[model samples]
Target: MSVTVIRPADRAAWLDARRQDVTASVAAAVLNVHPYTSQYQLWAEKTGRLSPDGEATDAMMRGVYIEPVGVAMLRDQKPEWAVEYHADNAYYRDEKIRIGATPDAFAVDPGREGRGNVQIKSASESAFKDYWIDPDTKQVIPPTWIALQAITEARLTGCDWACVALVVITWRGTLRLYVIDIPLIERHWVAIKTGVAEFWRVVDAGEHPPIDWEKDGSTVLDVYRDSYTDVRDLSDDAALDVIIRRYKEAKELESSGKKLADTLKPQIIFALGNSAAGKTASYDIRASTQIRASYVASESQSRVLRIKPRRDHDVDASRF
Candidate 1:
C-alpha cells in the first residue's frame, strides 16, 4: 500500500487529521494491550461521540520532552545509521486502513536493507520495569502497544524495519537508553488489521465495544459527563446491580481501616443522599454531609462506585 505523507501547517491541523483516523498512539487499545487506553474509549473517539483530543498526561509529556535526548543517544550509539528527525511534523498515513503514525524519526541503516521507522519514547523507571522487561527471563522487550505503534509507522512509511529508541528516567534521577528493533512486521500485519477492522465495524454499526469493566471506569464516567439532572431508576439493570455490589464491597474494605484506600467515604455517602447507611457483621457504616449556614448543593455531581484495576501501590500484603 502507498502511504500518504502529510506535513501539516500547524498543530491544529495535525490534531484534526488524527480525529478521523485511528492513529498509532492508541492503536493497541483496539487490541486491549494499551495500558492506558481502553477499546471503548477508542471507539468513542473515532465515532465522534467523544473528543479526540485527550489531555496530555504526564507520561505523554515526558515522551515529547525527552525524545531528543533519546534520539541523541540513538545517534551516539549507531553512528552508521543515518536518521532524520522531522521537526515540521510529518504524518505517514494509509487511507485504506484509515491508520496513521507520526514517528520521532526515519532511519536508514547502512547495515540493513531499507529505510526504518524510529519511535523515540521516554518511560519512568517503574514503567520500564513493568512493561519493557520480562520479569522472570529478565530479557528486555518492547511493550505490545509500543511495538504496534512502530509497526503502524513502518507499514505507512514502507520501512523494512521499525526501531524503538527509548530513554528511561529512574526514580533516583538517572537516564537509561536503549535501541530495540521490532522485527517481523509482515507477520503482525494481519493481526493488526483484524483488530482494527473489527473496531471500525463496531464504530460503523454505532455500537460500543464490550465493556472492559476493570479498565473502563473513568471512561464510563466521562461518557456521561453531560448527563441530565433528572434521576432515572436503574433497578431493572442486573449488570448495574452487580457493579454496585462490588462497589459496596470496596467501600466496606475502605471503611475497615485497612488504610489502603483513602477516605472517599464522605463523598460516597453524599452521593447516596438521605439513605446512606449499610450494616456489616463488624459495624454499621453511615455517611452524612454537614450542612453549612449558606446551604446550596453544587450543580455538578460526582459519579461514584467506579471499578478500577488495582495498581501495585494499591495492593496491601498485610490484608492477604
Candidate 2:
C-alpha cells in the first residue's frame, strides 16, 4: 500500500488557518498534533472510553491565559511572511503522514531581523523556580524548551532567525518574560529530530508510548504540591483522629442546618493608649487556649509566667 505525505507548505497553511480560527473564538480552543491523535486512539483502544475531545478541551481551557500573551508577542515581533504550523496527523509508509504543530504563535521577521515563536506558560511562583535552574548541571536553568520549539518552527518554515518568548504569569498577578536565542536552539536540532524519529518508530510499531509526564508524574500536580508545606508532622492515627473529629462536627452542623453566622458569635476588643515619657507599661494578661507556663525565681522573689501562642510577625503592607 502506498502512503501519501502532505507537503510541509500545505500543512503550514492549513495550520495557520486553524490557529486564526482559535484566536478569533470567544471560548478556549484546542488544536491537537499527530502523535497525540495516535496516542488518543491507543488510549481509547485500551480503556474503552472514546471521549478524548472532552479531556483535550478541559486541558486547553486550563491554560487559556497564555494565549493572549503569545498572540501579542507574535504580532509584535515576527515577520509578515511567517505563518503558523501545526501537525494534525501522521502515518507510516503504509499509511498517510498527518502531523501538525500550530507553533502556539509564530511569524517571520521582516527584513530578516528575527523570526520568533512564543510559548506562553502561566506558571505559579514555584513552577518558575524549575525553569531558572540548569537542566544539565541542576543549577539555575534557563528556558531552553521555549528556544528549542522556536528553532524547530524556524527550521520547519525555513526562516532566517528564531526566538522563543516565554510569558509566565503568576497567581499573584505578576508577569515574567524570558527570551531564548535561535542559534542556541539550532545546536540541539539534531538531538530533537532524532528523538522525534525514535518516538514515531515506536508509534508505528503499534506500541503505546508513555504519557509525557507519566514517568515523573504530572507537572501541574508537582506545582500544587510545592505551593504549601506539609502539615503532617502528626502520626497517621493522630491525623485520622483529628480528621474524624472534624467530620463529626461537620455532620452535626449539617443535621441542625443552622445558618453558619448565627451559630458562631465573634467578640472584638479595643484598647486606647498613649505614650507617657517613653516609659514601658504592663497590662493584665489572661490565659486561654493551649499555653505554656513558666516560672522565674530569684533569691529574693518568685514569679509565675504564662506564654500565649506566638502570632505571625506583623508585616509592613508597603513591601507588597
lDDT of 1 by residue, 1-320 (tens): 76788889987898887777788888898778898888887876676655346567886677777978888888898999898886667887878888888878988998879898898988889988988899999988998888998888788778888888888889999988888989855757777878888888888887779865445544554453332334333334433333344455666676673232232332223233334343222223333223234347533433333333223223232432
Model 1 lDDT at residue 202: 83
Residue 8, model 1, lDDT: 93
Evaluated against the true structure, the overall lDDT of model 1 is 0.68
Candidate 2: which stretches are off by over 4 Å? 1-51, 55-59, 73-99, 107-114, 133-145, 184-187, 207-320
Residues 104-153, model 2: lDDT tens digits? 55555555665555444455557766655566776434454445545454
Clashes of each: 0, 20
* Clash count in backbone of candidate 1: 0
Question: In model 1, which runs have C-alpha deviations exceeding 4 angstroms?
Answer: 51-55, 229-320
